[model samples]
Structure formats: structure tokens, C-alpha cells
Target: MHRAPRKKRRWPKILGFTLLGVVILGILAVVFSVQLNNGLRSATGKDTPVDTAVKSQLVRGIEAKKTGDASHDALIDKAAETLQQTPMKTITEAAGNQQKAAELVSQTTGVPEASAQVVTQAIFNDSKFDGVRKAMANGDWVQVYQQGKTLSSDPDIQALTRLVQ
Candidate 1:
């Protein structure tokens, strides 16, 4: 006698593929969430621990304006910025380069060149900074962070600040 033809089950294969697709979508969702959260954290306009760092160095510039290091101040600034600028040695060809520091302040803060002299006077070892004085000079000064931006408007300076930071 001829054997009867049997039906193939399609349910198992279909269920397996569906489960795989769900898992893949789930992973993508998680990765996207993490990226979005990080970007938002920095712009919360409040301290959200976007970056917690500790920097130590002798602060010059102004004697009376003396305060804590840049790393700690960054968290306190409430603008999601680390007021501390990158060291001259790390970003410039010269180790104790004064010009680079001046540029960052001038471009970032729009301060008169005459006022930025204090920027060159401070000494740092790799990572260091106290307050705005880290980038200050002479009698008194101001702030700028756009590209150097504690408050930045120039695209060129903004791009430059991003590169350095």
C-alpha cells in the first residue's frame, strides 16, 4: 500500500523568526535611549552630573577671586560646562605656551587683549585650574565659553572649543 502524504508544520519556524525580530528591535531601542539621555543630560541647565572630574593646580590671575578647581566648578556652574579650559601644553606645541591660552580667552570671552594677560601668568601641570582666573589676566576680566563657551556665539570659536574640549 502507498504511504499517506504528511503535512509540514509551519508554526515553529514562524514563531522563531518573530521572536528574533523582537529581540533585535529591543536592543536598538536601548541603545537609542542611552544616547539621547546623555545628550540631554549636558543641557539640562542644571547639574546632572554630566561629568564629574577633579582637577588641582595653583590659581593665579586674581588673588581675591580665588575659588575651587575647574572640574568641581564645572558641576556647579549650572550651565553644564566645565569652566576649566584645556591646558596650553596638551593643546599647543609649546608646554608653557601663553598665546594659546590668550586666544581661548579672547575668542571665548570677547575680553580686551590687555585684560587677558593674567591668562599667561598661571602655571599648570597637565590638568589644573581654579576659577575663571585660570583664564584671566591683569586687573580684572570676564567670561566666554561658546566654542570656549560658558557663553559662545562665534561658530569658529565654538568649533575650536569643541576640538579642544
Candidate 2:
């Protein structure tokens, strides 16, 4: 007796193509984000007058933050400036010795060594700061943060305030 013809399976092929399409879209999104970020950096670069022009055209909503005291704001700004200037390599190398790191942070930010240790540890191994490290791996953390009237979602600048407290 002759056997009936078997039906072709299409679900596997359809599923694979759908997955491939999703992956392609995801990659495209990542590339687009990177490109946009790079463009933003060039536009806002410190070395150029473009930054001033661009900033001037935009509405400035974020004023300098004050912790209700002049001395406190000064302390916070000092710590922020220290973190803003320090490179990732310096931070990582200093982290190799917790004491050294704390000393460096204390000297740079003018905070007490004990407070510096806390800030240094947070920068070195805290899970909460992992995102900040990744964003600032290139050492130019300015990309991931904003100071003065700029807006930033990165917790790094905020985290530095812990040093003063």
C-alpha cells in the first residue's frame, strides 16, 4: 500500500526568522544609541565654544544645588570636582590599596580619611556604582554626568556627596 504524503514543518523556520529579526532590531537600537551619545559629546565638548552656544539656546532648569548651607555646598562641590577630574585608571589603581585610595580621596576632596574610605569603597566595589563605572570606563566620566546647570541621571555625582556627609 502507498503511504500518504507528510506535511512540511514551517514553525521551526518561522520561529528562527522571527528570532533573527528581533536580534537585528536589538543590535540596531544599540548602535543608534552609541552614535547619538558620541554626537552629543562632540556637541557639548569642553574644548569648543559649541558647548556654550548649545547650552545658551536651551532652557536651563537645573540651578546649582545647595544643601541649605554654604559650607555644605562648598564641600559637595569640592568632592564632585575631585571625582570629575580623576581618571578610571587612577581610581582603579588607588582601589588596589584601600588605604591609599582613601588617602588620595581625602587629600583631593579635603574630606576626612574615614569618609574618604567610604566613598572610595563605594567607587571600587559597590554594586550600586557598577553602572557609573561602566559608563565612565573611558575615564572621561563627564559623558555620564553633568555638573553646574547640566542634567544627569548618573548617580556618580550624587554619590560623591556622601564624602561630605
Candidate 3:
């Protein structure tokens, strides 16, 4: 006797379930991403126009320094002026977040995080460079040299001193 042919297994159910799982995973991924972005924004606080401008200027300064371009000193001076114009509280907060900022800069510029941190801290926190900023604004090389002499021993300040001069 001839055996009856077996019915082919239907794959629509398996295909449907797989599609559903993929869609669910995609939705979850989107939701997770949105939540993460919101959390970071809340943690970092609101970014103002000045904050944007300052960050852009700081990045430009970093790029200039990395390239050793002729625009290096001008870019750094512009960043300092922008920082000086920003509120003290904002400046303090930026300095406090230097590590995070460095990570971001590293990601964007492909610079090492340690080097980015050095630049960020020197730009935002190192009080030794305040005189340099002032001297830059005043076009006073004498004051820049005086302040540089005092801070020459500090590696961070030395880096900033090199940038300024």
C-alpha cells in the first residue's frame, strides 16, 4: 500500500512570532534610548546658548592646540573670553563635569580622554591660568609671563602657559 504524503509544516506562525519579537525588541530599544537621553539631560541641567557657544569654542581651542596651528592662541583666548562671559555657577559646574566633558571630547575628536581631561581642567578649573586670561584680554605679555613663571612648575599650568604663549 502507498503511504499518504505527509502535510508540509506551516511556517507562518513561527515567522509571525519572530517578526513580533523583533518589533518588540526594537520598541524597547527606542524607549531605553529615549530614557537614557532624558536622564543625561536632567543630570547635566539645561544647556543655554552661552553654554553651547562656550563648548564650541572650547572644542575649537582643543583642535587648534592638537594641530599646533597658527590659530591656537586666538582660539584659546576666545574660549577663555566665552568662559569669562558665562555665569560663575555654570563655569563651576562645567569644571566639575570635566571628566564627562573629556569623555565627550574624546569621543568626538578622537583624542585620548586623559589629554582631553587635561585640556578641559586647564580651561575650566585651573585658577593659575586666570591671570593668563586677564593678561590675554589686556594684551599684557608682562602679566602673562609673571603668572606663567609662578605656575610653571605645574604640568597643567605649563601646558596652558605654552598655549597662551
Candidate 4:
């Protein structure tokens, strides 16, 4: 007697499963790469960590202000006020902090005297400016990070981002 006909396996099911596996693996790889990239960025003074650090500091300052930490709060307020003042006054003060870097950013970014003054003043207000200034002078990653942090915390940066977009 002839053997019963062997069942013909459906090619579609096999292909579908293989395609599904490939898609899943692709997604997983992308996620892993993103995570690895983030880790590397944090270690190398990249923008992400700088932005996060600045944002955290800003939030802490707000909390301090809310809790009535008068000195710290006042410092923040004074910095904000300075930025709103005339550009020459602001730039003059910033030049005392990091003359070269401040000058570079102002020139390279093509910021107007007024806006550059405010921006540089906001940068100098951050207590970390000394380290940042050194890094800026050397054109190091640290300076890039510090600049990113400064820009992230500055209200002017957000405003500029909005304007450019």
C-alpha cells in the first residue's frame, strides 16, 4: 500500500516567523545601541549628560527657592536680572570671567552685542564657570559639556531654540 501523502509544509508560516524574528531583533539592536550610545555620551562629556545636569541643577535651584533658601535664591534672581540689563554691562562682567571663550561663542554664534552680553552673563552666573572657562580655553570636551549645561539652563537658550526652529 502506498504511504499516506506526506503533509506539505506551508512556506508562508515559516517565512512569516523568520520575518518576525528579524524585525524583533532589529528593534532590540536599535534599543541596545541607543543605550550604549547614551552611556558613552555620559562618559565623554557629551550633550545629553550636560543638559541633564543643567536641568537637574535648575530644578534644585527652584526647589531651594521654594524652600526659602534666601542666599541661593537671591543669586539666581540677580543673575536673571543681570541678563535683562544692558549688553555692555553684562559683557563687561562676563569678560572678567572667561574673556576668550565668551568672545569666541559671541563671535562664532553671531550673537548680537545685546544677546551675547545676556548669554555670556548667564553663563558666568553658573558656579562651575572656572572649570568651564579652562576647558573652553583648551577647546576640550569638558568645555563643550559645560557650555551645553550653561545653554540648557539658560532661558535665553530655550527662547533661541524656539526662534530658530
- Candidate with top lDDT is 3
lDDT (10s digit) by residue, model 2, range 112-133: 9889988778767766555445
Provide the lowest-lDDT 10-residue window in model 4.
Answer: 84-93
Q: Candidate 2, residue 164: CA error in Å? A: 7.1
Model 1 clash number: 10
In Å, residue 160's CA in model 1 sits off its true spot by: 31
Q: How much is 59 displaced in model 2, in angstroms?
A: 17
lDDT (Cα, tens digit) per residue for candidate 3, span 1-165: 999999886798899999999999989866564344334545667544434554565566555554455576666565555544544334333334666557655654567888988877866575766766555333333454577577768887678567766
Tens digits of per-residue lDDT, candidate 1, 1-165, equal 998888899999999999999999999866564344334543563322322121122122222232477764553452223234443222222223566666655665567766665644553331333223343321012221111234245565468556854
**Could you tell me the TM-score of candidate 3?**
0.26
| Cα shift from native, residue 76, model 1 (Å) | 16
Alpha-carbon deviation at 48 in model 3, angstroms:
4.0
For each candidate, what is the lDDT? 0.42, 0.55, 0.58, 0.55
Check candidate 3 and list the clashing pairs: none
RMSD, every candidate, angstroms: 15.5, 11.9, 18.0, 13.6
**Which candidate gets the maximum TM-score versus the true structure?**
2
Collision pairs in model 2: none
**TM-score for all models, in order of appearance:** 0.24, 0.36, 0.26, 0.26
